[model samples]
Target: MEDGKLTVRAVERALDIMLCFTGATELTLTEIASRVDLHKSTVHRLLASLEGKGFIMRDAATDKYRLGYRLWELSANLSKEGDPGIILLPEMERLRDQLGETISLYVQDGLLRVRIQAVQSNQAIRRVAPVGARMPLYVGASSKVLVAFAEPALHEKLLASADWPTGLDQQAFLQQLSDTKLAGFATSVEEREPGAAAVSAPVLDRGGRLVAALAVSGPANRLTLEVMQEQAPLIMEAARRMGTMLR
Candidate 1:
């Protein structure tokens, strides 16, 4: 037990040192030690250990340390492993450019839909949602499509449970889900934001599993009901293309 505790502590310290390299292009031994709250010698030993394993590298010219290519390669592979964001960004950009509206990609993380990618429209008037922001599945168009196409059991669980109360009754929201399914996509005018309207479509993987959602949003006045109906097919097509790429 004591040995396990000691090993855990060592691992924690090592992780702290590794995390300190982020947001820094390069860091010297003293900088790393100060940020990681370890003595210089201890930090150096840990750095040497990590470098030996190809997780970090030291620059001969500046004597600074940076994350190694091995780390970069691993991160790249892991980011694309089950994530649809990487494969969808190119299409998202294309859609944004075509419609002159903001485009976003999101995936369900527990009860929240987390945005993983966004492209700002070039127009002077635009809608913007930052990457990594979380929104409830019950309110936004991007979130609702995922919930609409979700498995029946999971959909019932989400609807029956009293978790997210975005100032709407669950029964009414369930009716909205039915509507979304009928339309083959989800759309909202000022549901998430006061003056923004959006249309969203689901991205299904090769296994026909719901992987993510792609949404295009803009000013409500411009995105009328007729306009949304017209644009819905385009958004769905873009998502379908992304799904093919992911497969």
Candidate 2:
């Protein structure tokens, strides 16, 4: 039992060292030691083990360590493994067929949202949101849906931050979020992109936790306020279907 505990502590320390690389490209031994609160020799030992496993690499000239390609490979593989795109593709296709608008699935990543799947509209002038596109968590219908359904702690943090979308203050945004929650969905008109409008619904898991957002977007001219209001039910139904399948 003691040996197992020691192994677990070692793994945790190693992970702490790796997590120090967040928002940083490279770190020297002293920087890592300071961040992880470990002795230089202990940090060196951990670095050696990580280097051997290709989780980090040491530059020959600078002696600084950076994340290795193996981490990227593992992250990519993990993203692929847990990707909701494959599971949601059929629903997305069905919604696309029904609405004839661009369909996208967005998942939260920290304070940002990423588009994991997108099906472009068949029309010539339709909006296009490509897979892998990232946007702040405070703008657009999809982002608002995520924020509306997110934890209260996250809401407080985001509200306190200086990242509110243009022409919106904290009070107005909070009211908007409240309205979104009450309505069970969100809508935006030229919020993120000019002449683009979208409606989004939250996809929740079995435990009633927000998982992702399903959005349908198109040009504002075609997807006017009335049109979006009319299609709200369809968008929400599709979101419910996706949530059911995911659960």
Query: Residues 138-157, candidate 2, lDDT per residue (tens digit)?
Result: 88999889999898887898
Give one clash count per candidate, in the order shown. 0, 0
Candidate 2 is scored at a TM of 0.68
156, model 2: CA deviation in Å?
1.1
- Count: clashes, candidate 2: 0
Per-residue lDDT of model 1, residues 80-166, tens digit only: 665567767888899988888899988887777888889998888888677777777778887789888887776777766578665
TM-score of every prediction relative to native: 0.68, 0.68
